[model samples]
Target: MSGAKSVSPENRTVIGLTFGNSNSSIAYTVDDKAEVIANEDGDRQIPTILSYVDGDEYYGQQAKAFLIRNPNNTVAYFRDFLGKDFEHIDPTHNHASAHPKDVDGAVSFTIKDKAEEDAEPSTVSVSEVATRYLRRLVGSASDYLGKKVTSAVITVPTNFNDKQKAALLAAANAADLEVLQLISEPVAAALAYDARPEAQVEDKIVVVAELGGTRSDVAVIASRQGMYTVLATAHDYEFNGVALDKILMDHFAKEFLKRNPSAKDPRENARGLAKLKFEAEATKRALSIGANASFSVESLSDGIDFASTINRLRYETLSRTVFEGINRLVESVIKKAGLDVLDVDEVILSGGTAHTPRIASNFSNIFPQTTRILAPSTNPYAINPSELGARGAALQASLIQDYEADDIDQSTHAAVTTVAHISNAIGVVSLNAAGEEIFVPVVPAETAVPAKRTVHVAAPKDGGDVLVKFVEGNTHIKVTKPEPKPKEDKTAKVEDAADSDEESDFSDDDEEEEEKREKVWKIGNTLAEAAIRNVKKGGKVEVTVQVNADLSVILTTREVGAQGGVRGQLNA
Candidate 1:
């Protein structure tokens, strides 16, 4: 149960927030209608950016304005790395910048001190910056409502890990906001779609494609009466609004360099690159609506201005790969749900980036059912396209605060009745034929929560204590062996190759050479070990795994077919 469930709506000040990768917004319900709250600048969605001026902080629109003038002092895309280590390998994470550094395994930024320009800058954790921005967000909402706000329901990506969830919670706590519930973004969008007055019907298969600034979430949901069940979800970390921005930015940079032969490359200039990126975003948005659009950035490179025009055809050509990737991801999720494109009765499109014309064309190309597509502007009373997730979150908050057990049946919020299933397989560690430790998934991830499964594993020939290690996410986790040190002359080439993202040309083909192998990475905290004292070397042990709605994982081990067992809880 959520904390908001215990607080009556009349007694508590609650709001819903969407903490997106590149933007954030807040909303609340008034007279049973969801209303988005505008920030102090009168904007419903604010840029997820923060800038430091002489040790002082500026956020949102103000912070984004500093990107070109003070690139080192402004931070964007910090959300991508939250609850993540430095070694995480998404395209955004690998982009190097002097602004951010890893401090004691956490992300921190170095910013200038305006009070003392020549003095050394200071470092602050990413979480601290996030907290300050969240404080600003809630403060603005409080001002708009003319009341103090305490509780909130926030939305996150479907595949967020435990570390990310914990970090977000910490930031919310720092802002003096109690998170009533952290719901998945797709689930929230579905709730909003189903709540429409005209949407009443029998059970139907609905697919939601939410493309935001930083990521894309595709979910196939089964909605019957008022109950919603998530069948499967697929997402892409690299295919997003920022990636499209990069393409446009690169195109403009090339045009800029071509116009000025003596000027330094715009890509090499931090401020110039930032300016180009800002304009690139505007151009992309304009091209979404118009056949052709022109872009200009003043003083883009060493006092030289840049201006260029891109037609829709050219823009689409540049983004062909990304557009195709979205198609594949959508098809994959449908296949995972054991349904065909025709089986989907309705396809709801949400998020700001999904407004692009090409996205709609692609969807029509894939679904070929023009009438079934639900555009963002379908309802007059519905939440804004960009605010759909947050608005749905607002309704969920209301349901939790106002409704009793019996009265909740009419609510369309999925969090009230739906069970979000896991997306990957869970298994125990075992040795393969070549004696390499590998993961053997006994219970797949798509199983509904509050579910249990039992499997048996053979004891090692030497038979002492059997190790019970659970693996999650990827099953094939590669273990790279350290290459032997080569001669001094050969080391330089090896170093260059290692630093690059390309695969090495050298191949090992000796018949006797061992094949490269990988093992399953363990998940959660508890790794149980059961003693097999009197059993024979070839004996077996029974392992039972159970998952609860709270995501708690329990592992119980006993002798094969035995009743009593040793139990342990895995920490997530």
Candidate 2:
């Protein structure tokens, strides 16, 4: 075993994980600096794909290449399967199918007949598939670092719920990582940009527009007192770079149908249509700079003849809907953040699709008052959209880990406390036996933790269990009564008779009545005043109650309990 002295802070590392619409990535921080170090593949970002081969071997990129040649044995693009049910696939899309048990819900793919028969029919859990992919990534990182990595900080979408967060945490555990924290993706990007000397600016509200192949997300961020906070976030899963490509595919399909009128086979058309989608994406990228570009689709069933030339303007026009969706998302996020367009100081663009001029131009038109967009200076010769998100995640992990180190000695104050115990019976203030409701509060959620209060309650005529249901928020407490409704006429008649007889009752009311009441009951002898007098200085008269993630309560007081300390109980 390695000695404690051998395990230094330098050996401790934090890894960041991000899953976008098109792909997913894992990034780790090396050294004290926030620079990102990629795996042995020389690519900073890894495609979120997985496949299993004979001899119990699993493959990623290389296997993806073999997908076209050996479709029976390969799998690709399994990230879409995350958080989806097996029967959720659309019937119209040929690619939509049930996920393999081994693959879980990370993605979908075609497998060999033998493999299918040998495998179980149940859908793979997202955690299982994500774990496999993350483990492979960790292995690659470990190989490069030549050290034992144990901890990581994964990134998820801002909208991820507790269950999704648990799924991610489980995957990290499966990948052999001790997850230190799970930061949101947009928050991570803000951290990445905020760390840069050129990117950091005080009192500036910046917008991050991320356009990936499968989805697009926009977030507004503000920095205050060296802390970067995400003001708002918006995302559209359907409106992505792929949607732009599909628009072009529709145009190409019309032309293909016009030329190949006799083609009838469904499989042949599917293959042709798939190829056209790829071509459309390539052409779309090409037209970003070039005024026009011509693409050729060779080896159609009829012959090598499917080809077309598209201008930049025509391509932009065809993809108008996608551009509109992006604009709406950007506007909506800014609006949600309670900021006007002019309030934005800078606009930072990232993601794979941001490489297109049309995307940038659309953003410019929307935010005309803002300065030109700012992006990392990259070699125009080769561009990879995946690098931005990964780098951002790495930067975030570094910032958080650094903050943890710097603020090690600083204590965090508790924002909320738990309730100890109910002091008084909560009931509505009512008049007479009829009980007209007024103010009522049995228990409030924000009561101090581990608190005990003695409440005086009226004994019910018919003794039974007094059901106590704790509620939260500013609303009237609901009560269930066993008695039926009383007649209004009977109540009115009693009030009328009492008013008429009250004149003589007041005649005997003054000095004699006051002396008689004082002799009967002391006015100053209330239980509340007596309890307050006994409360000693520095002594916990009221217990502080704290609730945990499992909704368990921890009761602390000045005096210790028989268990040798404070009382702690887990609620069933």
**Winning model by lDDT:** 1
| CA lDDT of every candidate | 0.72, 0.53
Task: List the candidates' TM-scores in order.
Answer: 0.68, 0.60
- Model 1 scores worst on lDDT over the 10 consecutive residues at 501-510
Candidate 1: global Cα-lDDT? 0.72
lDDT tens digits by residue: candidate 2, 100-166: 4434434344444244556643334555657777787777767766776666666666666665666
Best by TM-score: 1
The local lDDT score (0 to 100) that residue 520 gets in candidate 2 is 14
Candidate 1 displacement at residue 381 in angstroms: 9.6
Give the C-alpha miss distance for residue 386 in model 2, angstroms.
Answer: 3.4
Model 1 over residues 35-136: C-alpha lDDT tens digits?
889888888878888777786777788888888776677777787667877566243532323256778877777767356768787787778878878898
Question: What's the C-alpha lDDT at position 142 in model 1?
Answer: 95
